[model samples]
Every structure is written in C-alpha cells, then in structure tokens.
Target: MVGFNGKSNSAKQIIHRMRRGPTLPDGGVNFECHCVSHLVASPCGYEFREAIKCQKAASEGELEEGACADELMNFMRCAIRTECFRSW
Candidate 1:
C-alpha cells in the first residue's frame, strides 16, 4: 500500500509491522504504524501468502483452477476482511 509520502510498501512488511502491536483484551491486536489500511490487512496476510503459493503452482501447471478453488476462496475471504480489494 501507499505510505504517507506516496511510496509503496510490501504487504508482508505492512502485515508484520502491524502484527507486532500489542494484543487487546478482546483477543485483537492494535497496530502501531500509521498505515490504517495495514491495520485491516494484517489479519489476512497468511491467507494472502497461501493464495500466492497457489497461483505460483497454477502458473507452473502444477495446479489447475479446480485445485485452486480453496486457495482462491481463502484469498477472497482475506480480501473482504481487510476491505483491501488489491490485497495482493
């Protein structure tokens, strides 16, 4: 996502930084960074990574669309959770 100065940062970096924040009483964590989008995106980072792996497998012909169904759903769910349509 774009930083305050309009520079782009990796999803992994954003997610990691956000996850470093303190855990709340409600079993949630608060982020320390100023990237508001990351706050929402962090929770879905694992799913995003899984989706990437699935895509890579598909691109290499090691996986088919049908095989990627679960990964695709997970990716979509994470995207929805983060409200980050461009989560990748």
Candidate 2:
C-alpha cells in the first residue's frame, strides 16, 4: 500500500512503468502556487495560510520552512528517498 506520502513499492513500480511508456494523464509532479498579496498583508491570514501549507507538506513528508517551491520539492524528494531506504 502507498504510504501517507504516497510512496511505496507499487508507486515506484508505477513510476518506472510510466517512464518506460507514454500513457494517458501525462503524469509527473505538478505544482500550484497561490499568491495572495492582500491576504499576506493581514497578519492572521498570512499565518493561517503558512500554517496550512506547512501542515500539509509535513503530512506529505516534506520539510518545513522551504524558502521556495523548488527547495520544497527537493526536500520532499529527499525525504521520500530517506524514508524508502529506511523501510528497506
């Protein structure tokens, strides 16, 4: 079964299979960023949004406090690899 972070032997196998052949959905990691200048200006809203993303990423095995999206993705990749290795 896939873990909370969505990583598992099956997940690895699926990724490998997808890499070997083209398939529907054109799968790979996709990221979305929301920019709310108005909300960021508010102290409570800024804290709330940041907290939500931090918690979500934490639950998904991503490192907290990434300075940028690229850093966050890299952190998640490393975290997933580390978890996989530990499981083995």
Candidate 3:
C-alpha cells in the first residue's frame, strides 16, 4: 500500500532568498530612508537584528512607551559609528 503524502516537494523551494543576512522584512530591511538586503553581511547587521527582535517580542501596548529602546539605540549607534549605510 502507498503512504499518503502532504506537502509537495516543490513546495519546499525557496522562491527568493534574501541577500545572506539575518531575517529581514518581507522585501528587505527598510530604514524608512532605504531598504537593505545584504545586511547580515554588513558591519552593523547584528545590531539591526537585535533591535528588530526586541521590537517583535514586545507586548501589544508595551511598544507605546518604547519596548526595544536599548536595542534600537544600539543599532542606531552602530549605524552612525560605522557609517555603513550610505546611499549609493
């Protein structure tokens, strides 16, 4: 007897992988000013990831005052200090 299979093998395919980085937003990491792809490969990638993670973990109302303030601050500082995000 044949066993029943659920998802198709084709379903496991990665349509479009981001530019080798920590999980970024659907399109990319949007800084309001711009969106980045190869962030994980960049200098300030870790800082950005930490900030996003903190923000995502916050409860519904907790973000009102500020949930990931420290993480966000750290990311901002890294960005400024490294000046890695310059417009091409």
Candidate 4:
C-alpha cells in the first residue's frame, strides 16, 4: 500500500520517468571545468564521454583506434587547473 501497486502508477508513467535525461542530479549538466571526479563539467564532459566510448570500442575490436587523444589532453589541462588535483 506504500509502493506502486499498479494502480496509482501505471507502466507508461514508469517508462516515461525512466526515459528522462542522465541519472546524475541537476539533469547532469555541468557548467564548469572544475575537474570534479576527473571530468570537466562542460565541453570536457562530452569529450570524455566520447573518449570512453571509443576506448571500449577499441578494446572490443569495434574500432581501429582507442580513446580520443584531444579530449584526453583537454582533461589533463583542466585537471592541472583544479585546486585539489596537485598539479605539482
């Protein structure tokens, strides 16, 4: 009686909720390059995501190359600027 009993929440409603954007809070939209958790919020997020996908594809032989080098460099730069990362 406390949870979905199939009456209050229909299957369609559940599916719609699941179809929403990234699982991360704030709609997963990071607006800065703070380098939190090794990922830049803005452009780096997209680049890093693609790089990871490419790496996976390479490991699986689905691609002739591995992760993106350009994005990796950008990530390094961002990491250096981050205060907690200790760029020294």
Each prediction's RMSD to truth: 13.9, 16.8, 7.8, 9.2
Each candidate: what lDDT?
0.60, 0.44, 0.65, 0.50
Minimum summed lDDT over a 10-residue window in model 2 is located at 28-37
Tens-place lDDT digits, model 1, residues 1-88: 8977798989997787556634434534333334433433566766755665565546545554376778779878877876765535
Candidate 3 lDDT for residue 63: 85
- Tens digits of per-residue lDDT, candidate 4, 1-88, equal 1235645666677766555543335435332323333453443555566554444435444444534566567666655554335546
* Model 2: CA > 4 A from native: 1-35, 60-88
Candidate with top lDDT is 3
- Candidate 2 has an lDDT of 0.44
Ranking, lDDT, top scorer first: 3, 1, 4, 2
Error of 3 at 49 (Å): 0.8
Ranking by TM-score: 3, 1, 4, 2
lDDT tens digits by residue: candidate 3, 39-77: 655798888778776776787698888788989899889
Which is better, 1 or 3, measured by TM-score? Answer: 3
Which lDDT tens digits does candidate 2 get at residues 1-82?
A: 5756777668677665445422224542112212333333443443434544554446343443443455445445654554
Index of the highest-TM-score prediction: 3
Q: Which ranges in model 4 have alpha carbons more than 4 Å from their true place?
A: 1-47, 59-67
Off by over 4 Å in 1: 1-41, 59-65, 85-88
Error of 4 at 67 (Å): 5.0
